[model samples]
Target: MTIVATSTSAFYERSRANMKDLRLKAESLQAQVGSGEKLSRSSDDPVAAARLRTLSRLEKLATIDTSNADRASADLSLADSAMSNMSTAIIRAQELATQAASTTLTDDQRAGIATELDEIQKDLLALANSRDSNGHALFGGESSGNAYEFDASGNATYIGTGNSQSLPIGDGQTMDSSMTGPQIFEFTDANGNTTDVMATIKALSEALKGGSTDPTGSANDALASLKSGLDTLSTAQTVVGTRLAWLDTVAERNTNLSELRANEKSDLGGVDMTEAIASLQETLTILQASQASFTKLAGLSLFNNLS
Candidate 1:
């Protein structure tokens, strides 16, 4: 007769696995309470858990990009303020030009006005290469560490990168975080052009201080250029502001998406503490009952030899 085997060890092995599962669940719940997060491990559920991990990393990177954009936006705002000051200086220069145009004014009085305008031009140069939040050049483009320098001839030279630095915000969107000094203050000047608007203004100031009529023509040229420069700066400020606004919208959207992903991740990998605890308690009870039954069975024997 063929007999099938029934092993006492089989029941204990199954019971051991159940006990291990309960212990894991208990620890998982404790971890959730400690971390204030639902999913800490992908082993909870491989598919949904893996996606959550990706989203979490992406969210972190997106936050940093948003911050980068914000800082870039702030630098642009600072540049705009500097440009505003320059605009004021230009207006003052125009007024002085009108005053100097009067035949009644002496050369001495015109010289005083020119002296003040020269100071204004120098201030504008200082503002153009101002630092951003990172102590980097705001208008130095991609090379924030570099600053605009002046040579012995008082010519402005850019020690920065040729390209604008870009930061990725989200969803394949990027923002040009900064502009180089040349883009803002330098221009292609021909024979009559001075190559740099600041230098042109500075030269006009110096020429005017000589009490000579030579600057009258040059000053008119500078005045036109200053107006055009202001228009360009203002337009750039407007564009940067619009991009920041769009980034703000995108950040808001990403925030919502991150939250949703977190919740989905929890749904996928997070064990319900209430249900899990209940299951744990029941498993423990079952284990105790199973152990008692095993003990009782072990103490019994199908055949007792009575010789």
Candidate 2:
């Protein structure tokens, strides 16, 4: 009969390796339970880790999109408010023009109305050249400076060079952040004449100073122009209002999508706390049993007997 001998060093080394393996497994389970993440590295589960990375990138992009949406909404809101003010100013100008159209008013009274109209024109021009939150021209289109500038003839002219500003708020979604100065304030009248509201107001103010042979006829013309100008302002307000409503809808959709992505990410990468805690307890129990068994076997060694 042949007898096989196992070296004491081999037994000790194997026992040490087994204990190390058991301890490592217990520690891993503990980490999963504590941190609420299943895998610490991609090597733990390559496919799941890859999916998690994609989700993380998407989440990061969503955060940026949300910020863009906020900025765009703010810009559009400022534009809407400015347009509303313009509409109110135009309405008040219409009232003044109607009052000046009365033959009962004297030249001095008409001149007084013109002075007020001049002030209103200046206010309207200032509103047209207003700045947004970014300090850029609100209606400047692509231009960085004022949207409207006065020519040598003192006529307010659109100095902007492009369409209104736009921003991407979300996936497949873009919003116009502003409207061009010309689009808001300049429109063709029924007479096929390109009417600039600022210029119309200027004309009305000049006519109110009473130099025409038929003063009442000139006043009536100014009143008609003022009515057309009010219509233009009203149309602009409607456009801005529609855009603002669209932004609200899109912003709500973006928020819902972001929340859905967060939930999906949690399902993909987040740990199941109950399962992890149970696994940790099981691993700890096994580690303790292994340690106790190793201690008992080591005590039975012949080296211990000799000692």
**TM-score for each predicted model, relative to the true structure:** 0.75, 0.90
Stretches > 4 Å off in candidate 2: 1-4, 7-14, 301-307
TM-score of 1: 0.75
lDDT of 1 by residue, 21-77 (tens): 756666666676556566676676677777877877877887787677677667667
In angstroms, the error of model 1 at 152 is 2.8
Q: Which ten residues in a row have the lowest lDDT in candidate 1?
A: 1-10
Residue 65 local lDDT, model 2: 76
**Candidate achieving the largest TM-score:** 2
Report the poorest 10 consecutive residues by lDDT, candidate 2. 1-10
Error of 1 at 9 (Å): 8.2
List candidate 1 segments past 4 Å from native.
1-44, 144-147, 186-196, 214-221, 289-307
lDDT of 2 at 11: 71
- In order, the Cα lDDT scores of the candidates are 0.67, 0.82
lDDT of 2 by residue, 64-149 (tens): 87787788778878988998899888888888888887989999998999999888898899999999889999999978899987
